[model samples]
Target: MALSLKLRQGLVSFFLLLLLLPSSFVAIEQAFYTQLLTNAEQKLEVHLYAILSELSMREDKIELTNNALAPDFYRPDSGISAYINDEQRLLWQSDSSLNQQFELPNVELIPGQHLFHLVSQQQNFWVLSIALLFDAGEQTFPLTIHIVQAEQMLLLPHQSFKRTLLQWFIGIGIGLLALSLLAYYWTTAPLTRLDQEIRKLEQGKQEQLNLSYPSELKVIKEDLNLLLANQNRQKQRYRNHLSDLAHALKTPIAVLNTSALSQQPELKEQLDRITAMIEHQLKRASSSGQDIWKKELPVRPLLDKLTGALHKIYRDKACPISIDCPEHIQFRGDETDLMEILGNLLDNACKACQHQVKLTVTDKPFCLIVEDDGPGIAEHKRQQLFNRGTRLDTYKEGHGVGLSIVAELVSSYSATITISDSPLGGARFTLQFPLEQ
Candidate 1:
């Protein structure tokens, strides 16, 4: 449900790309269109000055001294037109204005003053105007020269530029996104390798980190290797101390067995109890308890070995032992710990059952169920069964300790053991180990 580092980074990159690209495109397009408008106004101003240079006044009638101009000005519907006005009465006009009908803008201007802005009639247009004073016989007449160009003229090039700009921006966005993906992968590749190595270590496929790593990870690798070495040394030293203690106690117990204390049944019984307690405690303490790294071991083979030995021990009873387990099902823990748990459970089932015993293994949480056909245990007495040295005197000599040992081993691995009625009309002992510990 949680996202990975690589996926999170990639999502952020794509989100930024989506957000920034459109904003950048709109800003650039608006700037370009503004520049086009400014250029169009400047061109119209040039046309206005050209018309002023050729104007002349004769007998209060406006005329052109030289009627020379650009070819567009001489053609009708050319989208560019010029007009000369004196006090709102048209004095002169370009040939381009003969067919186009447009209302002139009202204005009050001082001589030598110029104005430029946009106007919208049926369509948009740019209008530029300049005011001048014309000299006649002892009088001055105010004249205004105007230039009007249609909006369609500028839109043609603007649209073309928009298309070209869109293509270029799209290409640039794609290139940047590709580079972002590459950078993401390149930066996370080392982490991927480190993850793989850690998985191998957990599965017991490798004892320590073996691959070369970046400097940041190298210190972690060395620390892990040192921890593993220290664990090995501690386990070895612990086993040695338990072995030495057991040997030291055995000698005194042997010597007492040969002395006069052996003649008294009470002393002999106490010595036997002490011996049993020592053995039980040592076994409990030496268990390879919950470990961080464990090997995957097949359950079927271990079950087979335990069942074989149980059959030999209970050959006289001839009880049928049924094992229900898949070949591929594995137990992830110490092999010896597994053997101890299964061996004791199956042995107790064989001893309790009158004619049948069954063992079932499940995969999801690594469970084991051992059942028998004898009378099932009463609910009231079930809790006391896990207590040390708690058993009926009618059972075999070693029966008191088997279930207690099972309880200790199961607890060490953080597993649960429950006693319930079995379908076979006997007791069921179910042990469930967590998949992840």
Candidate 2:
């Protein structure tokens, strides 16, 4: 079935070696054995020619038919057997151990000149034959000689050669396998370290990832660092913009409040109108600041801090503020952004309620619910309550900016806010945020 990386690589290399190596080795070995056999036959031919020459000298005759040279003339410790003949008869023969095992071919007695032949008998013995010509004073005599040798002796060295080649193949294959494993580990180590660094970056454990890898991965490391730097710069710019906007709105708001305290009847009404307009603008500026800063605040802590501050501020009214929020439940918006949202909604609820306010934080899908026991808004006017400066009670101290601010903060954070009748016979506000952002 399925092969791992190391085994797959090893098997591919081994098969590739098999494809190219064995045929070449076999071709070379066969050529070497053929050459050895040929050289041995040539040496035997030379010895037979020398014996013919000696026989001609003694008899002073050109014809070898009546010459007395023995057929065993070239016998030696090398186990060579010899035979001599003319075109007519079997003249002489050698008595070697191989003579009884094979029938030597009559290649030399075939009535030809310079003929040679090699034959095998019972697949075990090799016979070599050659035709000869001798000159005695311008008269030539034709003679034929035959030699036979055992096939086992000629084939001995070839078997040993094959075994030696097998051993060499095994040794080389093992050496290559060891080298491949070492190379694989050396090459993959740096890549493994880079993987670990990337995981740490994903978990937000590190501000930047650094890795020392080979030349090919250097560009990847540089690109990641550059991306992190750009994100940090964007966050800083958003924070600076919110601070500048808040600073610009504070002085105008103070001047309008001072003018509202003046005593001339006509001026007082104009000053009051100016103060109301200034307060509406100030609430818009405050909500805008929270929108910009909300990206840094988590959800649970912001709700806790808001409920605590509202309870303290409304203590003289004897209204109870109940909070139900889970610990460590974080949100994507900034702290000031959530503060502005919850603070305005709770302040309005406290002012409307005669005795009790309830705030519930459910962790299931990140929802905030606020309810109060007071005179609730009429059903027909609930839709207009979010409009700027739309106060139902003219005697209330605020310029009706609280609900409008709540609406704007919720919109900026991409959160949903809804108004409904409370179970306590007053208004209920529910805000919901997506957990995954």
Best candidate according to TM-score:
1
lDDT accuracy of residue 164 in candidate 2: 81
In model 2, where do residues sit more than 4 Å from their true spots? 1-261, 264-298
**lDDT of model 1 at position 269:** 73
> When superposed on Cα atoms, how far off is each prediction in RMSD?
5.9, 14.2
TM-score of 1: 0.67
**Model 1 over residues 177-277: C-alpha lDDT tens digits?**
99998997887777778778776766678878788888987898899889887777887898899999999999999999999968798888788778878
Candidate 1 worst ten-residue window by lDDT: 392-401
Name the regions of candidate 1 deviating beyond 4 angstroms.
Answer: 1-186, 250-275, 290-332, 353-374, 392-394, 421-435
Q: Which pairs clash (backbone N, Cα, C closer than 3 Å) in model 1?
A: none
**Candidate 2: pairs in clash:** 294-333, 294-334, 295-334, 296-334, 297-333, 297-334, 297-335, 299-331
Positional deviation of residue 143's Cα in model 2 after best superposition, in angstroms = 62
What is the lDDT for 262 in model 1? 82
- Tens digits of per-residue lDDT for model 2, 316-372: 898988877777655555455567678877888888899999998775566889999
Candidate lDDT scores, in order, read 0.85, 0.66
